[model samples]
Target: MRGSPPLPREFRLVPGRTFVDASVLVRLFDDDEPVRQAAARALVGDLNGPALVVSGPVLAEFAETVMVRLARPLAPVAVRRALTELSELTVVSADASLVLAAADTAEEEELGLRDALTLEAAVLGGCDRLATEAMRHGTVLRGIHVEDPAFGGNE
Candidate 1:
């Protein structure tokens, strides 16, 4: 699952906003993985850059994982703060076009629906980079550079 589909031709990392994946957000509060937590902090701490882009589904997934699926669920107050903080990012809502694009991505890239959805969301958000641990550390998907900020590959 870490392997990425081939990059599109004429790929370049543009100086645009980053699209964050739920995997990265979940690590922000993951105490078990101190290394990843620090990495997530370092990546998200900088607000000076262009606003990070996220999607409604990504935020919901992050919230649900932290609140219900984690080994130690965060308190209600912590979840609220996390949601509030994430809300500051540019959130893209999924629509029919996005879903259709995701379907094509899934078929073409041989990716699962959710992963394809995330990638398509990033593309729709007009992002140049995707900060995530779910996919390959340094790979281009639909012109967006994927980076695993926690694992130390592409920045």
Candidate 2:
């Protein structure tokens, strides 16, 4: 995910960074449902993260969702800006090791490939906690805590 600053094939958590999954990012900008929209907005607005952790897959996922899943697709420029905003965070590119571990984690956890990959990325990226709706709230996978910030919550 990083090039200019350069990142190792394996990522290391910067100091204090929480892994943010694409679901959270999508919710943050989505307004299809008023209650959920407000919850997402509040979650993000309340976070004053000194630093954040994200992966290449997470950014791509967010871009695709905002561009395709919304009631009206966002303009290319809008999508680009959103991606840029996310990319500005501490970014890590998932590597072969990460994928393999994710596969193991997925199999053990019975999670879909995407969910496992996101969780695996967070663990490998060294985030102590993951903000996502991909798994049960308070569930721990790969030693990383998972939490869904949605008020209405994952249904």
Candidate 3:
């Protein structure tokens, strides 16, 4: 069996240094939700990471949910504004190779397609950590650490 890859170098929490996943993004904007508040606080306040990293697929998925389906659907102008602000983040694109990698990761980890894609994007973007509320503690993907900001930090 192949050995697990080495962990990426530890990154100091500086501005522009971490990748923000869809889960965190959803929470950041959903102020009504407690989890979202916690994540937003952790990210925008405490983490102090430089240039948040976001993937194209992640943005598209978030837009579909927050702009299309949510009861208080985001207006086009609002969505555009959000996207523009997010553009300040280091955006990673998912190409053919990354798609294939995501498929492979899904098969290996038994994760759903979206989760696999998220993992692939994080790895490609050279993220040391992926912040999300969806994953449990101690979950590792391609040597990148998965952290649930809501439950983490106290440990």
Which numbered prediction scores highest in TM-score against the true structure?
Answer: 1
* lDDT, candidates in the order shown: 0.81, 0.74, 0.71
- What stretches of model 2 exceed 4 Å from their correct place? 1-16, 48-50, 151-155
TM-score, candidate number 2: 0.80
Across 56-141, the per-residue lDDT of candidate 1 in tens digits comes to 99999999999998888899899999899788777878887777778888888888888899998887677788888888887888
Which window of 10 residues has the lowest lDDT sum in candidate 3?
7-16
Candidates 2 and 3 compared by lDDT, better number: 2
lDDT string for model 2 (1-155, tens) is 21123236555554345788888888867777666567667755655554567899999988998899888778889989988777777776888877777777778889998898898778667677788877788877766777777634332
* Maximum-lDDT candidate: 1
What is candidate 3's lDDT per residue for 62-135, written digit by digit as tens?
77767876656778888888888777777878887778778888888888888888887787677777777666
**All models, RMSD in angstroms:** 5.6, 5.6, 4.1
Ranking by lDDT: 1, 2, 3
CA lDDT, candidate 1, residue 11:
24
Clashing pairs counted in every model = 0, 0, 9
Local lDDT at 117 for model 3? 83
Candidate 1, clashing residue pairs? none
Task: Provide TM-scores for the models.
Answer: 0.85, 0.80, 0.81
